[model samples]
Target: MSAKTNKGGAQAPLLGSKIKLHIEKLAIGGAGVARHEGVVVFVPQAAPNEEVLVEVSLVKKNYMEATLLEVLKPSPARREPPCPVASVCGGCNWQHITEIEQRKQKEQLVLETLKKFNPTLQFEYLPLKESPRSFRYRNRIQPKFKNNHFGFFARNSHDIVEITDCLITEEALTTKFSEVKIWAQGKNSKDLQRLEMYISEEGSVRYGLITDEDDGIGFSQVNRFQNEDLVQTALTWAGEDDYPHVLDLYAGAGNFTFPFAHKFKNAEITGVELNPKLVEKAKSKIKEKRMKYFLSDVESYMRRAVIGPEDLVVLDPPRAGASEYIMRALAAARPKRIIYISCHPVSLARDLNWIFAWSQKLGTPMKLARVQAFEMFPQTDHVETIAELRVDS
Candidate 1:
């Protein structure tokens, strides 16, 4: 355990030092935030408004990380996590906090993050859409197996936490844990094995070890129960206008492309995806000539995209969000309506800032019409948000 002194010659807390603190709130990553002697301390698995004793793990110049030793006073929202390995497994972070509180914190986190990035940003902040089932909603998961230990990795460590069941996962997959373990055992390897398990589109559980040739099922919404609402919300927000052109950026297996196609029968629908597996799957299901799926990176396709003022663009980028070039390109295109779906608040706000800035410089400002957060992955710190943008009148 090493400790360093600040430039002012003040000694910082050494590793393994015990600190009693009152948690004010949860940070973006599900860590309870508290200040000790003017230095911010982050304690994982600690609930907000709770008094807890923590042991310092790492000390930095302005902040410190600690492990929760004991909760002297638990928050009213705190509850026993349903999963047996909740404390050790890194799967669900908010299992200890009440589901209601989890949604509240996520909503607040998104709102605060957006406002923090752009203060003057204003839009209709709708209430957070709650998941129908907080637990048993996940249809896909990646579990690790090694040395007969079959489960997920521990928090911040590669050590596996064996589990007979996962609370947040759908029963369709949980019932096959024993079979998965047996399959993993037959691998006859000593190295840690990475596996992917999910219910296929045909409604059967599929499990296998990941390999270079077999990447398993590509990206898809894990929470199908709530994904319905997410898709519907995106479609409704897109409005009734039959735009001349419709583009679905980062379109994973035509989650939005198919829906948009059905809504706008005459409009030309284009889906740009980089993943060949996902593109192939999306293309296999398309039966209309007006619908096209292109296997190309979104940034590259955007460079050649010919968007019009009557075009509608729906982009659901990965967690890293879209690049500045894509944002600027969309701004310059001046699409009539843009639906930006983001899984991270910080990136969403930052991307929105770029789009609005570029629009202003181009003398075609974009307006954020409305925003809503979705509880797609309940019992986790992750959140999905959808924003409607239109050329400012």
Candidate 2:
């Protein structure tokens, strides 16, 4: 295969070249990172401290991507993946590595990424929180169905990887796989069938095709067991401050909103979510006059939000993370406490940088009190982090 540089319009001679590498560590995206000829090479399914043979696939100006040819020397954490389709499936990437190693790598990844973005930033780094169940913990999944195939997309490709069951998914959802396939067969469409299967809030398995008009049930924590602990951690970190107001930004179906309402009964709890369905779900459960749910994007809400020095803000933004304007607004508002729940570390680190930069500029400094990484999605590189921030008074 011919390799081409992503920039500079130059031909990459390393394309299709075979080389031996000692993987030093895993990168942010779960790729084993190694340096070859002074350029970083990223190989998927590689374990740290392992000697491996790889074939270079894509070459960029400063780095190259490779396919793992063979593991010459494997790390002790390396193990056989529990899933039969793990080799081809795109769902869980770190199944080849032991769970302990996965947690260790994840903890290191979060700390290193944060420090990389904010060099002098210091806060209490808590130990990684373990998931209640490493396997069978995923409560929701979006599987693809096409040409009688039912499974997830192939690694870096749109092609489907057929699988009878997913190891990372809970039994409640996995047991309905056959039934979902039968239901998909009734669709009778030749185009690639995109489907969503999840254990609903009612504890029943639900499945359906994803259409352009709708994005399915929307964002909710996939690991039910881990979510309980995550919610408690956020509440605990936020503390029992007698703030007059509480804000749950990016609130979905009142996951944290209702809990915050219960914890701070006197505080007026407000939730802002763009999805009308989630907003409706949240509003329907409102029991007190102090609770309010709005259907608006967080950036717009932050623009009009009346934040004060003693208010607590709990924001669980999506993977893309919150915007700069919102971060600047929060820094200016200088809430007494802010609990940020992030699923992506790079974005989280970037957002924190924004907050600190704005805080310094506005002369209302905010300090990171403590941060903890949660193993929300085990057998995958995805991690959930909760951070507490306080006004530097």
Estimate, for each residue in 1-393, the C-alpha lDDT of model 2 and write its tens digit: 334344665438778888899899998888999988668899999999999999999877778899999999998889999888887888989999999999999999999999999999989999999999999998889999999998899988999999888988988888889989888889898888889888888888888888999789988889989999999888898787899999999999989998889999899999999999899888888989999899999998988999999999999999999999999999999999999999999999999999999999999889999999999999889999999999887
Clashes of 2: 0
Displacement of the residue 183 alpha carbon in candidate 2, Å = 1.0
- What is the per-residue lDDT of model 1 for residues 59-118, given as tens digits with 9 covering 90 to 100? 777788999999999999999998888988899899999999999999999999989999
TM-score of 2: 0.96
lDDT of model 2, residue 95: 93
Q: How far is candidate 1 from the true structure (C-alpha RMSD, Å)?
A: 2.1
Question: Which residue ranges in model 2 land beyond 4 Å of their true spot?
Answer: 1-11
RMSD of each: 2.1, 2.4
